[model samples]
Structures are given as C-alpha cells and as structure tokens.
Target: MSVRRPAAEVLQPKSFSFNEKNLLVVDTILSKYPKEKKASALLPLLDLAQRQNANWISTAAMKVISEILSLPLIKVLEVATFYTMFNLKPVGKNLLQVCTTTPCWLRGSDDIVSACKKKLGIDFGETTQDNKFTLLEVECLGACSNAPMVQINDYFYEDLNEDSMIKIIEDIQKGSKPKPGPQSKRTGSEPHNNRVKV
Candidate 1:
C-alpha cells in the first residue's frame, strides 16, 4: 500500500523527548539488554512510540527513536514495519480489530465483520467519519480457543456472538470497559482436551 506522508510543512527534523513515564518504560526495556547491545531496545522503543500516539507510529518518530538508541534508520524501519502492532497511519480513537484467522472464522467472525460494517458503515482499514472508530481484520492474536474475538483499542473481546458483539461496541461507545475473554464463561488458558495429544 502507498503510504501517505505527513503534510510538507509538518515534516520537520525528528526529535524525541522521552518523558518520565515513557522513559521509565524505555529504561526498563533497555536494561534487559547488555550495555553494548543497546540496539536490542528497538521493539520496546517502538512500543513506547505506539503508546504515545494511541497505537500509530510515524516515520519521523521512528527516525527520532533510532537516533536515540544509536541504531541505523534501516534497522529501526525493519523493526517498525515487521511488527503488526505498529500502525504507520493514523488510527481511529478506537481501533476495532477482529481476528479473522481460521479459528475465528470458524466461530463466525464474518458475522461480526458484517455487523461492524452495518454499524460503522466502513470496511476494514477505513475510519469512521467522526474519526471515532476504525475496523481492521487482523491475523491470529493467540486467543483461538476463544474463537471469534476482537480487539478494541488495546483490549481483547473474545468468544463473541452477534448480541455480545453489539453489546461490546455499545459499551465502548458509552465509555465503559467491556468484559474480556469468552462469553461462554471460560477463562483464558484452559487446556484444549479436544486436540490430539502429542
């Protein structure tokens, strides 16, 4: 996909001001690496950037982060682009990402997607006119046992049927936190006995 650049006037020199909170996060991540291996902090740094921008990572921001850790631009770019967590473009205030992998699909995520389209009137990768929501179809988020699942903002909503899905969206719209995990009363981390044992 063609990346749309920021307006010419806004494209200025990359300067990163690491605030106390994010600096603490970066420092903690940086501590995990040996002194000489500061470059290993790239993913964590990218995460910090994402958190600051509500899940989006700007190229200029990446460049600035690269400079902070003394890593090459290409190195930072590779890390930024490689991870699905990083968003290159502006995301809506609430990003509604449904897992569309096999397990989720089998659990009726297509119906969830259709519901989202009906409610938001926008398909995946498109933002609502109010800029409040964006719908995206994502790959496995490792909640397959929960089957049909979606992530809003940074929280995951799993084991969804149509009614449950609608309720979750409405809750988010009303500024309430929806309960996470399966609607069927299963907590996360239940061992799947149905799978053939090794």
Candidate 2:
C-alpha cells in the first residue's frame, strides 16, 4: 500500500551526490543492465541514495538518480513515492517496523506494539527524541510462524511478548544488539518444545 509521505521541505538537503565508494557501487549496479535499459537500475540506485542520505530518499537524491538512469525526474519521483519502503521524510537510526497483521495480531502483536510505545515513549509513525528509534506499524514481514515480531533495521526479533519486547528495547538503549530470530525456545520456524513427529 502507498504511504502518506509529505515532502517535508524543511528537512530536504540542498544537494546530494553519492560518495566515492557508493559511486563505484552505482556503477556496478548500472553495469548489470544494457545501456539502453539503464532505467532498470532505478530501484537499487534509489536504495543506494537512501542509504547514503540516512535512510530516506530526498527530492534531490531522486533528481540525481533520474540523471544517472537517463530517466525523467518525474519517473524517478513516481517510483520513490509509490513504494512504501522509500521514506520521503527523515527516520531514526533504528526503524522499528512492528507487524500487526492478522498472524502477528493473533499471536499477540498488540502487546508488542504497546510495549514499543511505552518503552520508547513514542507511538506509531513517531521517533524518539534522541533519534535512536522510530516506531512504525507495518504489515506482515513473512515471519508468521514466529509471529509477534518487530523488525529493527534489517534484523527480525520474533516470538516476542511484552516483557521480552521491553528487554529488547532496553538492550538497544544500552548499546547492545539484541540477538535476532525467535525470542522463545523454538529454533527458526520449528515446532515448539522440539516435538518433531516421525
């Protein structure tokens, strides 16, 4: 689904150019596509821009991408605006994408959401004052079997309860990286209690 992302003009940077390392990455990505089809590199280019610009794609960045891909500025803006993954505005260092879909809800995702809100003192779509975390309620993240999960950055911490969720936040606050995956005894998506039937 498309998200409501305002331009938030005040936050926009005056200009954006990929650093030397990322410029090399951009070339590598562009080389995969035919010269005539350089437009195909739009997504990765936008991703690289977002990574370079602190996890959000700015209008300036999109313009640079359009120039690089030989695509129109509007074409790049269309893709960036249409995709929910592209954040138009600034986000925190740790984007906490909590899943509240049916599977996770049935597995007590509400409590997980509550834990995040309480622990961070910020509701969904809000960021902490320290810019450490941004709480967002997202759709399923494909870990239904180990539901009640929250994706912190690129890692998924699943099978969470209120207390466990609180602990995770506390660990992050203390500069410790909480281990990802099932928070319970189960390993991966295996059956609970290790009760494997023949």
Candidate 3:
C-alpha cells in the first residue's frame, strides 16, 4: 500500500541559517566526519537544530542542514521525515515522550498516560495551551528495566506511578529539573527497588 504523506508539509520556510553560536557547534559535528562523508553528521546536526528550534525540525532546519552538508534538499527532508525522533511540527518546550512499549505498558504506562492527559489537559500528540508541555506515546526509550517511563525533553523519569509522573510534570512547569532515572530511588542498574546499583 502506498503511504500517504501530509500534503507535503508546508515546511520549506523562506530560508535558513545557523546563528553564530550554532555555527561553532555545527562545525564541530561536521569535523568528526571525513570531508567526503560530512553528510554522516546530518543526524546530530539536525538534533542540535531541533533543540535550537524548540524541538521541531522546520523547513529552515532542513534547508540549513542541506546547505551545510552540501546535500540535496530532498535528501535532507527524507532523513528528517524518516526519523520519528525529529518532530516536524512545533512542540512545547518540554516534549514528554512516554514509552508505551510492552514493558512500559505491562507496568501501567496507560495509567501514566491518563495522568498526563488529566493533568496536562491534552491527549497524546497534543500540546498544552501554555506551550509548556507536549505529550506523546513513543516506542521503547531503551530504559525498559525502569518501565513506565516518561522522557521530558532529554531527561528520563522512570519507575513512575501516576502520582510521581504528575509530580515530575509539575516540577518541570515550576522551572525545576527533576532528578533523572527511577522516581522511587531504585536506579536502573539495581537488581531491586529501593536501592541504587553500586
């Protein structure tokens, strides 16, 4: 079956450029790849641009990345579109990616999702009106041992119950970064709850 795409995503913005600050970063990422394979840095550059662009990879990001890698626009767009990790649309400041894979689901990920929906008043794939948070149900985040986890931006909040999950969102809205990993003090490396792996 042919996969349908969103009416070509009115994403190609007028133009794009990396600011002076990101120029340094872009150069550094590009430097890690041989000149002949500079395009390999596309993923990292796109990620940096997403962080710089409020978690979405816009037309500007695609264009800028294309220019930097001396690649075709379609090539850059293809990569960006293929990866779910790159949000094509605008997202709130804190992107809450809740893992709903088997492990997390078996461990009450549904309840965590419900709590987020009730607390944030937006369903998965929607952002709160205030733009502080966007909710999403994603695949495994590679932290299954700590199942029922939610990643706010770059940090993982794992071993979550509804209460702890909601509390983490509250802390984020209050401009505080909750400590990452298990909420119950059972870090992921541990063999049991209530203990950190030494």
Q: Pick the candidate with the highest TM-score.
A: 2
Off by over 4 Å in 3: 1-13, 193-198
Candidate 1 residue-wise lDDT, 15-126, digit = tens = 5566778878887888899978989888878888878876677787888788878988898988887888787777778889988999999989999998887777887777
**Candidate 1: misplaced stretches above 4 Å?**
1-16, 189-198
- The CA lDDT at 93 in model 2 is 86
Name the lDDT value of residue 33 in candidate 1: 93
| Model 3 lDDT per residue over 113-144, tens place | 99998988887777777888878889998998
Clashing pairs in 3: none
Give the C-alpha lDDT of model 1: 0.79
- Model 1 Cα RMSD, 1 decimal: 4.4
- Candidate lDDT values, in order: 0.79, 0.89, 0.84
Across 1-198, the per-residue lDDT of candidate 2 in tens digits comes to 112234553468878899999999999999999999999999999999998888888888998998898889999989998987888888888989999999999999999998898888888887788888888899988999999899988899999999999999999999999999999998798888687778
TM-score of each: 0.84, 0.93, 0.89
